[model samples]
Target: MAIISWREQMSLNYPPLDSEHQAFMKVINQASEDIKKRHIEGMEKMFQACYDYVRNHFSHEEDIMERIHYPEMEEHIASHQLFIKNISQFRQEFETADTVGKKLDASQKAMAFLSVWFLGHLISRDKPMKPYLVRLRNLPPRMNY
Candidate 1:
């Protein structure tokens, strides 16, 4: 089963950012599946992917916020930083796990953390940015960051 299912309410109504968010969630769900299948290597790769996605997506999103002069930019960036720290801690635990049972347990904890954090950030942080981001739709800016 998936760790977290993306729902309509999660949509920020911004396609570029929404797609980025969805891609990260896909990594999380895949990691959850890998844990169930005892695929430690797969989980490790997913962790790397998660790190990459956050780095790139947060940069991109932050840039957009800057462009739009979003009032909550600092707070949003702080939240992103906190997410990184928490995920890094989970990765440390997963990496230090020696046995299959230990690795699986760490993976579950990481997946649970990802699920909770992602949902909370999307609902509280990202949702509020929707109004500011909607302006970009008319401008049609590139999101390749």
Candidate 2:
């Protein structure tokens, strides 16, 4: 049970970006599902995968933005940096806190942070960048819809 699930509406009309975002949601959902199932041993692995995948996604998007000469590139990068810091803090907290198996779940803060971050970044930053990406990439990017 995660707070959010990936939906077609979230697509940025860019195949690579859409696929990356879907992968992110899948990883997050899998971690949440594991926690709910009380799969104690694999929690660390799942969390690490989530974090690593996100870093990869961020890099991918940033590289595309750079090629576009996106005017808001620095601001978007700063926003991403803030997100990474929060996620890193959540990982640290999850590592040190000694909670029982059943009690372990994604913290509300982490869920909220992710929901807002995804929505805000996609809607505010991502949507606007699509045309530039399209023109720069000069290809029809895949999308969920």
Candidate 3:
């Protein structure tokens, strides 16, 4: 599994939000590496943490989106739902695997899925929302996540 690489392109020109995004990527990357190393138990905990982080992050982002009257809020949240679905699928695979070996085997593709989803979303879909977000937010929104 490949680690999610953060770069300038990932920056939405919003420092606070971008920082949270970076942390999200960090958690995902750690989980990916753990899975790749066949650290099954570590991987499981990290993956759970990743899911929790994503949900909290999305909630905070959505709140900002709503407060700022972000027009694409629904679509953005829909994207979040897709990520959660992917997370659930991986969790299911991890849970159903009869052996640590099977878990690791299944983890490879799941990590890849997460890497691709994160890179694509942050660079393409999420990045495009920044301008409107900047205009709407006007200031850093309160962060509860």
Candidate 4:
């Protein structure tokens, strides 16, 4: 079973952002499955992939927020930074466990953290951007003569 599943309610009504979010969910779901199977290698690989994707997605979002001059851009960027830091810490812990040849339940921890954070962010943080995005989308196209 996937830890998180995308639904209509989660949609921000922004296609690019929504697509990226869906991809994030899919990666986490795959990671959760790998964890259940005790596929350490696969789990680690997926974790790295997830981390990379998140960094890229965050950058992309920051760019949009910048372009839109989002009122809460600072707070949103801070949240993204905090998330990256947390994930980095988890990655270090996973590496330490690997080095010591101890079976650490890092995968479970990672899944739990990501699932909760993603949901909360989607609802609380991302939700606010909907109106702004809608307004942007509704703008008339510029035509150059």
55-107: candidate 2 lDDT, tens digit per residue = 78878888778777789899888988887788888767767768753226444
Clash totals for all candidate models: 0, 2, 0, 0
What TM-score does prediction 4 earn? 0.87
- Compared with the true structure, all predictions reach lDDT values of 0.87, 0.70, 0.78, 0.80
Q: After superposition, how far is residue 38 of candidate 4 from its true place, in Å?
A: 0.3
lDDT per residue as tens, model 4, 26-137: 8888887887777888778867886787778889888778767789889998988888888887787787785423434766777789889989988887878888886566
lDDT of 3: 0.78
Badly placed stretches (over 4 Å) of model 2 are 1-3, 101-108, 138-145
After superposition, candidate 4 runs with Cα above 4 Å error: 99-104, 138-145
Give the per-residue lDDT of model 3 (tens digit) for 2-86: 3677788788888878989888788777877787567887777767776776778788788778787877788888998888888
User: In model 3, what lDDT does residue 134 have?
Assistant: 61
Best-fitting candidate, measured by lDDT? 1
Residue pairs with backbone atoms closer than 3 Å in model 2 (clashes) = 15-141, 15-142
